[model samples]
Target: MSSRDPAPTVSADEGVPAAAGEPSSAAPVEPAPVDVPAPPEPHRSRAAARTWALPVGVGVLVAALFTLYSLAQWRAYVVKSWDLGIFTQLAQRYAALEAPVVHIKGPEYNLLGDHFHPLLVLLGPVYAAFPDAFTLLVVQNVLFGVAAAVVTWAAVPLLGRVVGALVGVAFGLSWGLQHAVDAQFHEIAFAVPLLAISLAAALRERWRTAAVAAALLVLVKEDLGLTTAVLGVVLAWRARRPALLWLTAWGVGGFLVATRVVLPLLNPDGEWAYGSRLDLVAALSDPVGLYDPAKGYTLWLLVVVTGAIALRSPFVLVAGPTLAWRFLSEESGYWAPTWHYSAVLLPVAYLAMLDGIDRARRGRVRWLRRYSRYAPVVGLTASLMLLPQLPLWQLTNPGLHFAGLRAQAARDAMAVVPDGAVVETDVGLMSYLVGRTDVYYLGNDNPVPEYLLIDRQGGGVPQEWGDVLQVAQILHPGVPFEVLHARDGYEVARPLED
Candidate 1:
């Protein structure tokens, strides 16, 4: 049986005692009230965790993939001489605390005087530790990966984690980025992540952060100051802030000073060689010649793949200066997809696309709202379709082996040459020798080299070198030379005794 209920209190006026097991005709005592708060929701915490997990995971995965691929290329010795060699030598000089000069161009051709990129000095310590071209390759890939991560972070708030992850993947695998990675290092590597962070901050209306980030672009390249100026204009117009408009004006002013006054002062040539192509009217007239049709098609594909959403955002304006610079330039290389020229544009395009999608979701237009839901799917599909065309796929082919007997022999041949020797080599071998040897390109108008190195079967050396060796002659036919080593398309010769 249940315990008996407490007996009611009896009134004193009643003056009666209650009988055992019987209730009195008095009121029962009331229990005191106590406050108890509800427990927190587990689902809310789980949802927050899920929100960040996908984009972060995607970012890490893509970065790892690109890094591995680039390292593989480095091991394969597939990287070229013109840029990678130049940068590696400059970095080596910085590491040694010497003036950053390049002998590949000529003895004592100061890199600082060539381009006002003081930002490269920061990599000096890193190069000291690693001391190879591979170090630069890995660093560049990591910088780009950081950019992809930044884009992912920016996208998650607007598009949700899943769609944001897709955006990150698309951006990391984009043609511009892939080409830049395959093409070796450039100053633009620093610009990519900086631009991404600046744009991401701007999108969130973090004005001070955005301004600081944009302003730092001047350190990357003088021309990038113009891009920063355009960003300032975008921010000022969008937020209606007068102070931001002044930022825009200052950006332009800074660009002029950096390009016209400062760079000229530092440059040995007393002028910027890059400024020679500023004829706007001529560039506008023959637009067809400025860009390849295939590249033009890719640009069109990029827009359509995003459902043309990029065009709807003001961020698209950031792409204008870069595009105009490329098209208007007399250099045909700028118009092609072969280099890092277009890499800077990828961040702007994708960020603008994301912004447009966000705007579409909030607008009253019904069709756009529906289309916005499928934006990630469209982006992913387009990225996947273009994957086969990328350099990463070439790794799978057996022809691109990193290690073999012939390669090892060539490497051994390069090693036999002592450090600090004045040598002339083909374009392909110049990079390997740049840091160790006073190497020069084997071409017409070359000074008489003390030693001649060539790849006979590879056909990289000039045809004239073959006749010289056959005739036992040097650049100065009067200077006799002795063959040092000749094997499997690799040949090294030195000046003979008098």
Candidate 2:
């Protein structure tokens, strides 16, 4: 009786049949199919707009501050005549659509031959419009700021919002980047952003964009080719893409050609003057121990400031060759944080730090996970503490205050020297006279200038009245030249003929 006992019971009002073993009222009802369209794909542009809003805002703020600070430095006449002057001269020639010849380096030294930096050609258009040292400074600051923005954008996905913002801030305010800005113009300014974009693109698995970005770094500086090569290696390893490996060869080959073939061909001496520093063994074996302890301390601080997490990522290897090259150089200048050499390293360091943070968050490393959570705070605090040590601190000091009277005096003296005249002057005055005249450093070789200018009260290479007389007599013997104008410690002397 129990085997055949189950039967469906029908409802009095509804027509739908119930299951064979269930009562009609107790059966489950199927819902009618409703046409619900998938939520319109989140507007990509709007989503991107939200994603980039914070980083762009932060980048603009940093860039504005840096630009104002740099402009102040320019107005105060704090910029030196060496690099700033040399680059200005090159840019001026580029603006005029002429070969980028810099007389400040020599009588007519082609800048491209000296450094193989074709990237500087881009500045020609900017300087063509603005045509001043201040314009160059502004361009550099803006590019660096953009680079920071790119870093922030990259870090956000890996480290979350807060840590990502810290990475951007730390990178923007890094002593190396600030020092490069303070030191005036450098080819590395372009390299910084390009490298940041390349790393970010690689992390996002945008292989073609990454390759393009990495390849362009070669034009920024010859040595940066090595960094690009490392980027290729990292991309190939992570994505298991063989075609991208060609970038590695491109970078290595570009570096060799620039240094060995192109540079020598362009050099007047038939050899790259900077080649002496390439001997790693010699640099490592410094007998005088001139490598300052301060430099070592700076190196340590750079590493520690990254929360020591950068070392965990393979991307950190991108910095290895640069660090090695710089540390191995016999030049003490290369060892210090005072110059722009470390500017390119900042992007690499911060990107690697973000990668490490991502890895820790995904893994079971307790201490790393804990540290990663607070890394932004740690990085920001470190940056603020080190702020005073940067050139930016000079902004608050009175020493950099712009002196209108002194500036006028210098300008007036430069005005007296006719355009196209060959002039020899000290570092402080060289930048002012570059584009208007054929300018040369006071002590470089046997520079016989049609005019001799100097600031008797200027803060540059010490020039006594006797030193000018001595140089004039040695170079232009028996050619009588008289002071055209002398006032406010600024003097211009010209040949009687001119």
For model 2, residues 41-142, the per-residue Cα lDDT tens digits are: 889999999999978976887788789788777666665448888888889998989998887787668887889899889999999999777788888888
Please provide, for model 1 over 170-268, each residue's C-alpha lDDT reduced to its tens digit, 9 standing for 90 to 100. Answer: 887788888898788898999888888888888888888878888888778878878888988988877778688766676688778877887677666
Instruction: Determine the backbone clash count of candidate 1.
Output: 1
Poorly placed runs, candidate 2 (over 4 Å): 1-41, 284-292, 398-405, 445-448, 457-468
- Deviation of model 2 at 142, angstroms: 0.9
RMSD of each: 7.9, 7.4
Residue-level lDDT for 56 in candidate 1: 63
What is the alpha-carbon lDDT of model 1 when measured against the actual structure?
0.76
- Give each model's clash number: 1, 0
Superposing every Cα of model 2 onto the true structure, what RMSD results?
7.4
Which residue pairs clash within candidate 2? none
TM-score of 2: 0.86
